[model samples]
Target: MSDLEATKTRYEVLGPLLDERLLRLWAAREARAIGSGGAYQVAAATGMSLKAIQTGLGELDLLEALPDGLPLTPVPGRRSNGQRSQPRVRLPGGGRKWTEDKDPTILPALELLLADEVAGDPMGRQRWVRSSLRHLSERLAAQGHSASPTTVSRLLKGLGFSQKSNKRKLGAVGRCPERDAQFLYIAAQRQTFTAAGLPIVSVDTKKKELIGNFRNGGRSWCRSAPEVDEHDFPSKAVCQAVPFGVYDVTKNAGFVVVGTSYNTPQFAVSAIARWWQAEGRDAYPGADRLLILADGGGGNGSRAGAWKVNLQERLCNRHRLTVTVCHYPPGCSKWNPVEHRLFSQISKNWEGQPLRSLDLMLGYIRGTTTRTGLRVSAELDDATYPKGQKVTRDDLGKVSFKPHADCPIRNYTISPQIADQQA
Candidate 1:
């Protein structure tokens, strides 16, 4: 083959395997191996700039002058000893300098813009920019700082800033002063009950779902997308599915009762009672005490007198077990284990799938499992529970309730009442 063709063929074989430095050196070596005007020929064949080839030739000349047996500049390819040479891709401080270094005021301008509408802890080292990168870029440009959105992103990252969505962390309006104290008390109760090997359950009624062909919030793999109703009208629904979950903290198990009836205190207590009969008793054999973690609002809410009365009748007296109830602070229901562990998994499993029937909803709950060996069981309760059922003072007084010294409203115990127990 001709010299140019030979050079082109060699480069095609080895160019992809070499970095910038190695490519330049290889091109220079090939040019030198050829006679005069070899640089022009190599350049035409390999498409390398003449300056790079000349730089490589200069490096070769320097290498020739150096003494033998001294450590040489590392080469890119494998050595005679079968170990690969570790070489610098470029010398230190090589390549284009960063945008911040080029324009010192760019960082300050970015920070000023971030501070204008910053969210999150002001004192935190890691903060996020509220403005989009494009908007920030435009703002910086208007202020005489020439920066692209990509460059602005890099600079923001260097300054411990990132793009983040709004986190649902802040509490609802009128933050309760006793919120922190209630959390601490709940932690203590968990520790005490866990140490004694008693069953501790986190209970909550999940958001009621309309039973029928409805649009679920997530995507799933299917041959064709399932058609659902355009509008989620209650009148269009066949029924509503209210899933009351009891999550066993120690066992990492879940018991969900799907009720078609109203989510009243009676239904909530009956769900717990069902869990105790189906799984709790068998799991914690001979245990006489139970701990329940619930939210401050709902059918099993701390302030629901009927909730306490039902626990006294169904769980405490009927089962002969002492039930200690702890309610999470207002607007803190997400911290409840049932919400994340059991309910979240069930939501994920059934996402994009229409709950066309009560059976389908129960099936999704029953099939839900987690990587942490979580097992779930679900049952359907077609029984009717009318809402707004009030507990009289006489009935509430008969609960044999004992409020704890700390956060009595959120923490209390209901012991089994004797046959002749006084109000």
Candidate 2:
């Protein structure tokens, strides 16, 4: 066909004689078989190549003017494509929403405004974007561009920017309420120390730093250490992990003690003893009983039956906080929100920054914070931690903790030294 005939084929239904490049190319070519036109004649009428007309016919814009209620063909077997080829749209439930044609340029501006407004405030609620767009489009008439506010709004919505007030809203709930509730619960628990005429404080040493050469959890080993055969080599280069602790259920308060050695009961008890003298004492003024919620694994883990024995005598007896302990379920230490709310922030704030100096680590730990708060008490324990010293069972007998009626539930202990020194 001649190019004119090719273009004319597009709008044949409108009339073969009404072929004009500007109108057909702009309006009629926006459809594939739209307004009862065939693609071949559309190329002839619009002067577009038959190939260009054919190519544009399948696009969504071409069919924009088609009546929405028109019957459509059913493509079958989509799910199980063979015997299951069936009328899918007629199948119900998740059918598409029926809507009107909209402008494309309006969508970009709408989305830009919505996203710009939503960036700092995820709760969404920015109506100014829609209002401003409508105003701008209306004012454009004075500036000589023709468009309506309603039309602008429709285009904005089509681009996924909500003209309706619903788009900018936050999720059904935010973390603040839940976190506040938790703080309140923990605060109540802290008060129990007074109810029982005891002083209760959340106590655990911050993860310890090694005083000498040692392996760290994040090491880039040639092979997994756990997979290494016992015969392969000695696992000797392990650095000591530091111990971190919070007090009185206060996310805003806590401290860390750097230990020169951690392999022995003396190192563990001494570090803890120092921590108590430093911060724990201040948490409970005019207090009698000292209840500690500790995991069952660390220096004080139930397994370290000896550490508890030492704490009972050397630590608690000296302070006179009627110390009783409890332990959490095994392998579940992270359930302690303090780790993330407190310790995790500390680690994150300090990553890539070296703990090259003892004071540096102390500085970072004290600076850690959350939406709740930050606090840290730290001291360098340079007096030798007396490694390789073992406290015997006879020594355990000398250490005495004022017993709790329900020791298991009231006081917990844990001591699986972390794989991560900073954890």
Candidate 3:
């Protein structure tokens, strides 16, 4: 074969396996082997232009001089007047320039505009001025700096500022000293349960969704977007869906029981009971102890009297199982595994789709899956759970429970009092 034909053969063998840089280097090396002005010959054989072959040869020469690990581009002598070192795809400094960089005084002007300096007030009224981006842009223009609202927004972000909405995360009682301690104790309890082959579950009630043709919070890919009611009035809603989720920490499984009525303690315990009867009992046969992780407020709150009483009556007494409860600190419900693992998946499953009927909602929950083998089962609880069902102190005394020494109010275990069951 001719030298050109030999070069073609080498390319055909190594082309698929080699990256762009390696391929270029290989081509240049092959050209060097064929003697002086061999770049023209290699280009003719490979269908690469003579200019590209010459560039490749230049790259090879640079590689010999360059340190082993330095990247091919950004060579010392190759750069010219802010242009890229090499003649390739991307230009040097090719991204959108910061507005603040374009006009240095724009940031300081914005800070002045936002600053609250009342002429006479000692405290200066308020430090934050919530003005529109367009208004700010106009003010900047008046100060001899030309900028659009979009550019102003970009400048603001560069200066560590952003458009923020009201956050309701701060509850009635702010951060507690016992928060970290409770979390650590809960973690320890979970580890103990998991090691002992006992069930550990995170339980929480998902936000109540308005039933019927109401506008959901997200969008889905469809030929055409589904039409929904413009205004979401409670009168127009068919009913509200209260989804109580139970997430199994060990197995990565979820169970959601939807209720049509009030989300009372009775309803919460009932959901747990349903999950135990349907899935838990079969999964862990003869398992006597159940560990529950819950939020500090709402239907299943640590302070809720009805929640414990219902647990005693519906779960402990009826099922003959010891129920250990751990309540997450106030305003920390978002950390609950059920909130993220179960409810988040459910929301994503039925995004932009109207939950017109109970069956549709249940189907969405059941179909929810994750890459980490999350299996979910959902059921509708049509039972009438009456609100305002009070659990007196006398009723609480009847249930036998031992508070953990670490955090008494937050961690406790209610053992079944049945003599035969304990035996």
On TM-score, the leading prediction is 1
The list of candidate 2 runs beyond 4 A from truth reads 1-191, 194-199, 205-241, 387-389, 401-423
Q: How does each model score on TM-score?
A: 0.65, 0.45, 0.63
What's the distance in Å from true for residue 367, model 3? Answer: 0.9
Q: Give the 10-residue window scoring lowest on summed lDDT in candidate 3.
A: 117-126
Per residue, candidate 2 scores C-alpha lDDT tens digits across 25-142 of 4433454434545554454455556654543443234345557887643332236545544333233434344323233344444443343122111112222341376665765555
Q: For candidate 3, write residues 96-173 as lDDT tens digits.
A: 676677777777888666532101111111112246788888888899988999987777666446655555744457
Runs of candidate 3 exceeding 4 Å displacement? 1-173, 419-423
Give the alpha carbon lDDT tens digit for every residue of 1-423 in model 1: 999999999999999999888898899999999979999999999999998898788777767877998887654443548876565576668777988888988888887676324423311223444468899899999999999999988887886667767567564457678977887788789889989999999899988999998898888999999999999999999998898999998999999999999999999999999999999999999999999999898899888998988899888889999999999888667667777667778888988899999988888888988777999999999999998887899998788899999999999999998878833
Clashing pairs in 1: none
TM-score of candidate 3 against the unseen true structure: 0.63
How does residue 32 of candidate 3 score in lDDT?
91
